[model samples]
Target: MQKHALPETVGKNIKTKLMLSATPLRRLSQATATAALGLTMLTAIGTDPAKAVNLKTFNISGNFASTALDGSIGLPVNLANGSFNGAYTVDVDQLPASNSFVNLTSWNVNLVNENTVLGTLSNSLAGNTAYIQENKLAFSDAGLLTNENKNLYSLELDFDSNFTGTGITNDGKFLDNSDLGSVKSSGLTAVTFVKIEPVPEPQNLAGTAVIATIGLWLRRKQKG
Candidate 1:
């Protein structure tokens, strides 16, 4: 007995289904490769050194005794992962001056549960120089400044007697004598704290490398 032949439409339908299935697999592979390449690029970006520097600015505006002081202080820090672990710089600019000499001897940076002393900038001006001065203070131990609380920090300025003047004043008192008295500036009128966080280096270098390798493989597969 002769078997009936299959219909032509049946063969066409089977061929169409097989083609559709193959197309989906190819598309899925390509999509996976594209995603891997994107991940690799992100890893490379995370490990780049150029993006690891963070800059912040704090402004102090208020009266220091009878003189009004206002300026922007720059804080440039290097971060590893999410923590500070490198050299940092504090730049003071637009310092205020009055008829009497004003010397900034030291500054105290107060964070949560910790206080840091920044003392005697290398280029700090002293004596009876009645002029505005700018200073740059560099510290290598910025890791100590980090705190879990990211709130605004306070700055306290310490001034020696030389800040007033070196000569004897009308009251027959030597204004520049450190033993006589010292000045501390606080009670800021306007305090503005700014924090800038740059892109940090990858915390896990090995993981990043593995991710990059996988991404490269995916890209090659896509190209092939």
Candidate 2:
């Protein structure tokens, strides 16, 4: 068996633990004695690729003012005026370009008022137009060089403007990102633009957060 660097106290414990499976130590090179102790730590470092973040499911959550738009719509819960949770999957294991807009393969979001999940809206049903987009570059509209910029730290989601389907309220209205979240001068938004982001992996012993992005964007949902 191979031995790696480990502290003296832990090395002794390993020596006792691995005795039945391995040979007894004939001599101590100080480093050779360190065997069996660092197996757990070494296995973790060697198998990093297998543990990399392949970010498959996205969990979305956000709040709306108590006086937003759902009141007049007659939803069971005031989702437009309160908070809700939604999620989506692109079926692919990657993200879109920082400046590109692409449709999601499927999505599911709760049509929740302040305290109730009236229903869940999903792509399995009709009118599920979910997409992700970001604007990392500043564009010059008519050569004026607009100073506006979308966040590079977080990704945002938008459904079709007021997509009405199974979740439509009594008045025949649904709550979505109604093309209102404009982070740039170009003016683009939906019923709501809730930020999407990857919950960062806990820092390693070296204090480094290993964030493996599939494409780009989707780091954290901090608006710029």
Candidate 3:
């Protein structure tokens, strides 16, 4: 039997289609490998102990009448331990005589997730000052400040009267002065809380952008 060759146009079209089809598959494989490698690098960075530690600082400020209060909390973090030393300072300045003569009855710091309290500052303070007071709290446990556990966290303070005066109250997280029979301070009280997270390094940001671009390209390829 004699063999016949296909038409030139048909042969060319078939070759073109094959090449076009193989091009996407090859690119897709490369993209997938790049994405996987990027993710692996990120994971290693997260788990590496030698990397530079990052700390997130949250500053909270509150004011009532003439009293102005500032609070700062710091959490030291790294990938391997995911644990850190937690330190906080609460300062009360420009306190009015009524609220100035107040003692920190019980102060509590919580790692909160929505309505749940994940961790707390176990240390306590008493009789630290005569009328006005400043409290510095620290915890050695590395588990208290891990982002792996919760999405949100907060520090709360409770106060009591050191002298006979109108009850000290806060518009923010401060609770009512249960020791004194006065209601929580109403009006002219405001509190603000701010959280600051460390900025990622340039190399890490570039890696993130690469991963994001790969994801977007994959999505577009699938749509096509």
Candidate 4:
């Protein structure tokens, strides 16, 4: 039996060498597959696409004194003597071009009258908070350019103050005060605006790419 096994092993070795010459392509194909897998693994580990862009901020103000003629107050005429005393702001993902305007979503009014019961009418943050987010009366548009070459967005708000009066008694509703009868108060005392931006869109990023050479270099090297 031992003598027979030795002769079979020798015959198998001889056949293996003959088969290599007949199908050298099999060995070449195996080597090529192994190399491709190695390259693919390296790329997956080293060429991850993850990055973030910077954030932007914008300064804005809301005008509580703009007249109804300018599409601000819903009232017929000026009711607050063009005296707007509210705070507001507007922000976009990026700076808008000229002629661009943002819709006014909603707002809260902290109407304050010095002669009210609490010395101040209502604090918007308090229980008497009166808000108007439903009406689409407020909006902002890119303002006229200034000497500093900066563009601003203007916000407008208007009010009515003719139903109450300071001379008779403290009715607590300064908005109804008749002293500023039929006059719409719309203007600003203090204002602020802020905006933030995220990464560019995929198409925009592709268009702005300055470097797409890493993969190209690798492919060229592999070909060589």
Which candidate number has the best lDDT?
A: 2
TM-scores vs. true structure, each candidate: 0.24, 0.35, 0.23, 0.20
lDDT of the structure predicted as candidate 1: 0.32
By TM-score, highest first, what's the ranking? 2, 1, 3, 4
User: How many residue pairs clash in all the candidates, one count each?
Assistant: 0, 13, 0, 20
> After superposition on all CA atoms, what RMSD does each candidate show versus the true structure?
20.7, 21.2, 22.3, 20.3
- Where model 1 places Cα greater than 4 Å from the true spot, the runs are 1-7, 47-56, 64-224
Backbone clash total, candidate 4: 20
lDDT for each candidate structure: 0.32, 0.42, 0.37, 0.34
Candidate 3 residues 1-224, lDDT tens each?
99999999999999999999999999999999999999999898886576442222223222222232232112211011121122332222223235233332223344333344433543353212222332211122222223433212223333344312122334233211111123212111122332212235578889999999999999999999
- Per-residue CA lDDT of candidate 4, range 1-224, in tens? 45445587898999998898868788888999999999998888787665543232212222222233333332213332222233332333322313334322223333222322211212322322222222212333223234543322223222223211001111111221111335433322222211212335567667656345666777899999
Ranking by lDDT: 2, 3, 4, 1
- Model 2, residue 1: displacement in angstroms? 68
* Better candidate by lDDT, 2 or 3: 2
Off by over 4 Å in 4: 1-97, 104-111, 115-224
For residues 44-156, could you state the per-residue lDDT of candidate 1 as single tens digits? 88765653322322222111122113332212110001111111122222232333233333322212111232222222222211122222111111211334322222222
2 versus 3: better TM-score goes to: 2
Q: For model 2, what is the alpha-carbon lDDT of residue 111?
A: 52
